[model samples]
Target: MESEAAIFAGAVFSLFGGGLLVWTATCVHNHRPVAHGVRPVPSATLAGVVAVLALAIGTWCFGRL
Candidate 1:
């Protein structure tokens, strides 16, 4: 039961993280500035990539359990 919950949570996180990664990439490609230049493209891209990676790891761990 706990494992199932963890898997479900992981799935949700992974889905959102993946979407964020795609959105960030699209923003960077289209040269769209964010937050009035408060958040630079490269920084946002890197953060998104990291978030996706973290979520992937979490998903894998949940699956393994």
Candidate 2:
């Protein structure tokens, strides 16, 4: 049987991962076009940070299981 701690950790990972995905999706700015036609910095940074955090959290949580 799985331990309570593992189950809790897994739940937290799932929640955070899903939340991060949703947050990243909304970080896009559709109002303006870039001068250089490149992706804006803020949205990219937001996605990167969220993705890294989610990965780190998931790895840590899975390791505990």
The top-ranked prediction according to lDDT is 1
Estimate candidate 2's alpha-carbon lDDT, on a 0 to 1 scale: 0.64
Alpha-carbon local distance difference test for all models: 0.73, 0.64
Q: Which 10 consecutive positions of candidate 2 have the poorest summed lDDT?
A: 27-36
Whole-model lDDT, model 1: 0.73
RMSD of each: 2.4, 6.2
TM-score of 2: 0.48
Question: TM-scores across all candidates?
Answer: 0.66, 0.48
Q: Which residue pairs collide, candidate 1?
A: none
For residues 1-65, could you state the per-residue lDDT of candidate 1 as single tens digits? 88887887787778777777777777778877633556676677676777678678767857876
Candidate 2, after superposition: displacement of residue 2 in Å? 8.2
Off by over 4 Å in 2: 29-40
